[model samples]
Structures are given as C-alpha cells and as structure tokens.
Target: MRAALYFTPSRDSDLTLAAAEWLGRDPFTGESVVSDVSGSDGLVDAPRRYGFHGTLKAPFALADGKSLEQLEQAAAEFAASRCRFTVPELALGRLGSFFALVPARPCDALNAFAGDVVRHFEPFRAPLSDKDLERRRKSRLSPRQDALLCEWGYPYVFEEFRFHMTLTGSVPAEQFDDVEELLKTSFAAFTGKPLPIDALAVFVETEPGAAFQVQSRHLLVSAETEE
Candidate 1:
C-alpha cells in the first residue's frame, strides 16, 4: 500500500471547518483530485474519494515490507517534538493548471515543516523505479524541482514549494474560470474574517485505488494573533 504524510487543517481552526463545509458542498472536494484528473469520468454521479488538504509529502510505497506500527511510531515521535506554527490568511488561488487556496505570504515555517516531514519519512519511500523516472522526466521541472525529485522522490519540494488546500478535481480549460470563481465565492464566506490554520493532520489511503482517510491530527504552538 502507498502512504503519504499530508498537511491537514486544524479541527478547531476556521479554515478547517470551512474546508469541511466546502467538501460537504461538493463530494468531489473531498477526494484525490489528481486521480480524477488522470482518468475518464464516464460514471454518473460517482461518489469521490479523499478531500481538501495540503500535501506535506507525496505518496510512496512502504520500503522493505515495513509494518504500519513501525511507521506510526516514527510519525508520533517526529510529531511530538514539532510544534505547529500559525498559517497566515490564505485565499483561493491558482496553481499551474489547477486551482487551490494557498498561503498569501511566503512562509519559512511552512517550508521548514515540509522539510521535516520529508526527512522524517525518508525511511519509508520505496526506491524509484524506471517507470517513475520516465514519469518525472515528462514533468516540466526546474533545476530545483529536478533536485527535489532526485532527493525526495517527488517534485515541488523545499524552495520550489507553495502550500495549497485543494478545492476540486481537474477542471477542464473551459470551466476553469467558472470553477475558480465558484471556489473563490465559497471561500469568500470565510476569508473576510480571520481564517487561521494551526494543525497538521495525517490522512491514510485505504487501498491501491481508494481515497485516503483521516487517521490522526497534531496540534502546534498557536501563533500570536496577527492584527
């Protein structure tokens, strides 16, 4: 089974609650948008899998047949020492070909946490196969992006990263503006007021093709409120 450590919103934060509302507004919001984008949606009214959450680490298969307990222990140990930092107010924004809500300010704390996740979870990543290499080559990678893929087994890490809470599956080019507007309007209900992010959540994928489920959450040191 493949597993990933992700950035989930706090249970009590305004943004977290808002995200749940968005997901409830549309089941598609609570699923792996990447998968839907990669496949054909021929089925009618299919319930989607997974939901809105920022990715701290991309998915990777367990190495050397590791046990889940071992991975959990490692995660708990790593999480215990880490305190959460406040995520500044972010708004709905566009990411390359997709749209998501991203941090408004460039945040070092976010990058630091992402680095920690990579370092902590490096032991579990299976070695990249030839197929993986081919897939990555097709990606339009910058120097830093290539470096991150080589070192971390995924692109968009460290200096080449931005934090995003995904809102929907792949939107076609024509519906792009409409979807963006819709998501923005939905978010608008939460943005004018304070929308704080203050926790890291762990979401677990149930099966090979299944969506992920929230297994646990961690609290961070709450940042002093910004005026």
Candidate 2:
C-alpha cells in the first residue's frame, strides 16, 4: 500500500462538496458524484484517481517494518502540536497544462508547514525503486530537482513545491478556455475566500493504479481546543 499526506477541506464543507461534484468522486466517502459540467468526468480522470487535495507529502511506500497505524498515530500527534492557519485566498489559475486552485500570493506559513511535513515524515518513506526513479527522470528534471529526488524520494519538496488542488488533467490548448470557464463557474462560491488549514488528511492506495481513499483526518489543535 502507498500512503500520502495531503490537505483537504473538511468532509462536509462547501468547498469539499463542490470539489467532489466537480471531480466526480468524493475522497471522503469514495463514492461517485454526479457533475453538471460537460465532459467533467473525462476532464478530471487523473485528479479523481488521486482524489482532490494539495499534496503535502507525496505518496510513498512505508519503509521496512513501518505500518499504517504507526503513521496515523504520528500524524495525529504532529497535527496536535501545530496551530491552525488560513490561506488568505485562492485563485483558479493555469498550472502548466492543467488548471487548479492556487494561493493568490505567497504564504510563508503554508510553505513552512509543508516543508515541516516533508521532513517530519521522511523516516516513513522507503527509498525509491529504480522504476520510480526512471519515471521521475522522464520529466527531464533540473539538477536541483534530481538532487531532491535522490534525497527525498519526491522532487517537488521544500522550495520546488507549488501548492495546488488540481481541477483537471492536461487540457488540450483548444479546450483550455472552455474548461477554465467551467471550473470557474463550478468553484465560484469557494474561490477568492480564505481557506482554513486546520487538518491533515491521510490517504491510502491499496494497490498500484487503484483509486486512493481517505483513511483518516487529524485536526490541528488550537489554543482553545487544547484548553
């Protein structure tokens, strides 16, 4: 099994519900959702497989004798030690060949938090297999990214990471505008609003090429909550 640390809205939040309908699958319940957007199912096939989330720590195999239970416990404890914060706002924008919800501006807290997650869980990550390394290399990674991959098992960590909640797979150039318009309409309610970063979600993929599902969500503890 492969596990990923990700940040997703609360299961019943408006943003989560809207994203579920747009992506055609609810990561929380692992159920199919009916979408109003034309061709949405095909458009979101890629992100739908992984579920909608901002990647915190990329999926990794549990190292050696480590088990899922241990990872969950560690995540819970880590979350409890951290304070909640909010992204000032998010905007729908093009990220390479796809569209996603990205922060409107730089967020130092979010970056630091993501970096901490990557380093904190490094112990649980198994070294990348040759096949994994080959696949990552196909991206023609820069020297710095290749170095990060060798050390961290995922190239996009720390400074290389760009937080995004994917909305579609690669859209053809001709269809980009139409797809972007559709996504904008679908996500209008939540876009441009401060998004709470209060929890860490653990997602699990039972086997290779299978759809990932949420295993659990650990809420961040605040002063009031701790009290």
Candidate 3:
C-alpha cells in the first residue's frame, strides 16, 4: 500500500464542502477542461483514483514494508512538537496549467508546517528513480526552480509557494484559461472569508479496492499556547 500525509481543513473551516465539491467535479468536468487545454488524452484521476487537496508529501511507497500503525506512530511523533496553524484567507488562483485556492494572506506558519512535515518524515522516503525523474520532467524549470526541486520535490517552495486545493491534473498549453474559469465560477463561494487551514489529516490509499479516508488530523494552535 502507498501512504501520503496531507493537510485537511478542520470541520470548523467553512471551505470543506466547497473543496470537496470542486474535487468531485474535477473527475468529470475537470477531466474535460484539462483535456481541452493540454491535448493530453487522460482521465484526471486514474493514478490518484481519487480527487484532490493540497499535497503535503507526494505519495511514496511504505518503507520496510512497514505496517500502517508504524507509519502512524511516526506521524504522531512529528505532530506532537508542531504547533497548530490558523491558515488565513485564501483566493482562488491559477498555477502553471491548473487552479487552486491559494492563501490570500501571509502564512509563514503554513510554510513551516509543510517544511516540518517534509523534514520529520523524510526518512520514510526512498530516492526517486530515473523513471520518476523522467515523469516529473514535463515542466521545465528556471535555475531557482531547479534549486527548489533539488531541495523540495516540487519547484515551488517557501516564498515561491502558493497553497492550492488542486482542481485538475497537469493541463496542456491550450486549455488553461477554460479550466481556470470553470473552477473560479464553481468555487467562488469558498472565497468569502479566509478559510482556516487548522488541521492536518491523513488520508490513505492502501490498494485498488481501498478508499482513502480521513484517518486522523492534528489541530493547529497559537504559538503562545500548547495545542
């Protein structure tokens, strides 16, 4: 089974339903938008076999063939030292060829949370093979981008970062605008007030038949007090 860590909204966050709805539409409507833009013939969710959210850790195979309990224990330890974050207001945004709800205000807290998650659990990951490198090469990078990719698997990190609730798969050059517009129209309700990124939830995909459920989430708290 493959395991990944993700940040999910707390129940208190009003954007949860909106995020879920956008994800639901992504498989169907989003597939078309991405297909129209990129000319890539594919389903948006075959690999994920699921919808979307911000990826804290890209999916990796479970190490040592470890049991879920062991992985959970590792994550629990990591969460203990981390303080909770109150994610600020976010606005819908367009990335290279996709759309997401990006944090509208400054959120150093969220960035630290992401870096911490990567640092603490990095031991669980094995280096990416040639095959993985080739697959991720579709997007070209600038020197700065390359540096970020060397440090973080993705080119956008820290200040160069923008949090997005992913809405589609990689899009082709042609259809970007259409997909962005579709998402903007569909998810406008979620932008009313800044949505709090108040928790981190673990959603696991074990096998073909398994469903990724919200197994657990840790709450974010003010730095002055313990969470």
TM-score of each: 0.78, 0.98, 0.72
Model 1 residue runs over 4 Å out of place are: 11-14, 24-48, 192-197, 221-227
Instruction: Give the better candidate number (1 or 3) by TM-score.
Output: 1
Q: Distance (Å) between predicted and true CA of 86, model 2? A: 0.5
lDDT of 2 by residue, 133-207 (tens): 999999999999999999999999999999999989999898988898898899898789898899999999999
C-alpha RMSD values across all candidates: 5.6, 1.0, 5.6
Q: Worst lDDT window (10 residues) for model 1?
A: 38-47
Quote the lDDT for 28 in model 3. 19
lDDT of each: 0.65, 0.93, 0.60
Overlapping backbone residue pairs in candidate 3 total 5
lDDT of 2 at 174: 89
| lDDT score for residue 43 of model 3 | 22
Best by TM-score: 2
| Model 3 weakest lDDT span, ten residues long | 27-36
Q: Please identify model 3 stretches exceeding 4 Å from their true place.
A: 11-14, 25-50, 143-160, 170-182, 207-213, 221-227
Please give, for residues 13-102, the per-residue lDDT of candidate 1 as tens digits: 555555555554222234322232212242112213555578888877788968666777677767666765656667677766666777
Would you list the clashing residue pairs of candidate 2?
Answer: none
